[model samples]
Target: MPWFPEFSSAAELARREIRIAGQADPVAQYFTALNEGRTDALEVVWPGEVVIHDPRAGVVRGHRELRTFVQDNRSWLAEHEARIEIMASTVVGPRAVVELLAHVRYDGREVPWPMAVVAESPDDRSVVFRTYCSQWPVDGRRHVRPPVFEPGHAEPGDVVGRHLGALASGDTESILKTFVPDGYVAEPIGPDYIHRGADELRSFYTGTFSEGGGIGLQNCTMIDDGVRCALEYNLIAWGTHAVPPQAGIAVYERSPDGLLAAVRIYDDVEPPDSR
Candidate 1:
């Protein structure tokens, strides 16, 4: 017997059908198929060129790989008794970022898994899914993830460009200058590991630079929706140690004065010595 039951009512089935037929938003349709474990419905919405960059499974391209990936993911979720609770979603143009809490019952205990997914549509017929999350909840350990996309240059005039510049320069004051006094930064582990306010932010960055003058960013993609800029990059270097670059994404929200108001990061990148 399947853990998620099939649609129970004709009206519900009708709604699902309508949604799968592209009547609803693409991102919503994708999540619907995932939550309901409906591969058929997924096929109706996904184009032939669909690509999935999963943290655990890696990159899966086309319908065949996607089907297998979805099935495997569904099985894993079921095995852990997992349910997704969407925290927030930000849609800018053809890109959508969704933040979710994966509630799972495992090892006779329950835990919340923090994760985020970015969906980008190049055309109506092609879509890319990039997932970001910590692996600790799933396996009781952390695993390094490969870069999802290649790095590109940041536009010199943008806020992200400025932040990167400050970061690379190891100028703590310059980095802090890019953020509002009340801004907060949430590291990849989760919301509870956030560094809030100027004092906390100063302490965090000071230590970061002390270990390494600056870190290198590769394969950078920036998505801006007026209010926020989402940057996906490979964190290649930290401090003195040069380890394999790992995948990470950070969303930067700007204050009214154009300074960074908040930064939420999602990744499983470990310390240099750990590598």
Candidate 2:
């Protein structure tokens, strides 16, 4: 059962509390298959090749690999006692991005891990899922993420455009102006890295631009519903150091007054200076 917008109306989707309520969303079904350790449902739904690019398991292709991957992740999920909370979702053309905030036991206590899963259907015959998140919450280490999508030409507008533009030029002050006085920038790791207000954001951006350049991100797919914008991109560089192209997704929340309310990143790209 797929709950695609093409089958349902936008008004109806807005009425639902959670998008994964039924056996609809393919991404939801993927998690269900992993949690329950089953693969028959996935085959029945797509009946074609299913590819998954996970942070830990790497690339899983076909049902054979998916079965093994599901079993392994199920055991890990049970051990961690992950309580997944549904967040917002964005749908554009063949791509559907669903954000999940899961609270899992880590280092002796529960930590909220923000993750996003992208489901792209090239046709009715296949589906590609690429998940984005910082592994720091789970293992306290950042892994270098490989690029998932090639560079795209989706240039966002408004404050998101300003933020990205400022970052591309390494203009710390201009980037800072894109946010409201009390806006916050949250790192992908966890809530522990959220930088709020002007002073804290200033401090964070100052260090961010200390490399003599801003964070280099290549624009990709972006879905902006006027209120919240979800951008999937490949991180290309970190200041002066050229990094391997890596994939990441960011959700930008806009304030009512046209400034950014919050910016949340989900990626494993570690800084060059990180020690």
Candidate with top lDDT is 2
lDDT for 70 (candidate 1): 74
lDDT of 1 by residue, 59-175 (tens): 889888877777777777788888888876778777888878888887888877888888887875677888898877657677889877677864535666788788776778888
After superposition on all CA atoms, how large is the RMSD of candidate 1? 5.9
Distance (Å) between predicted and true CA of 45, model 1?
Answer: 1.7
Candidate 2 residue runs with Cα over 4 Å from true position: 1-24
lDDT tens digits, residue span 1-275, model 2: 56676567765564342333322477787788877888766766666778999989889999888888989988888999987887878776667778898899977899899999988878765788889999988888888888877888888998999999998888978988999999999889887899999899989988888888888898788877788889989999888889988889999989999999999889988887752
Model 1 clash pairs are: 150-219, 151-218, 151-219, 151-220, 152-220, 212-239
Pairs with backbone N, CA or C atoms under 3 Å apart (clashes), candidate 2: none
Query: How close is each model in CA RMSD to the real structure?
Result: 5.9, 6.7
Q: After superposition, which runs of candidate 1 have C-alpha atoms over 4 Å from their true positions? A: 1-24
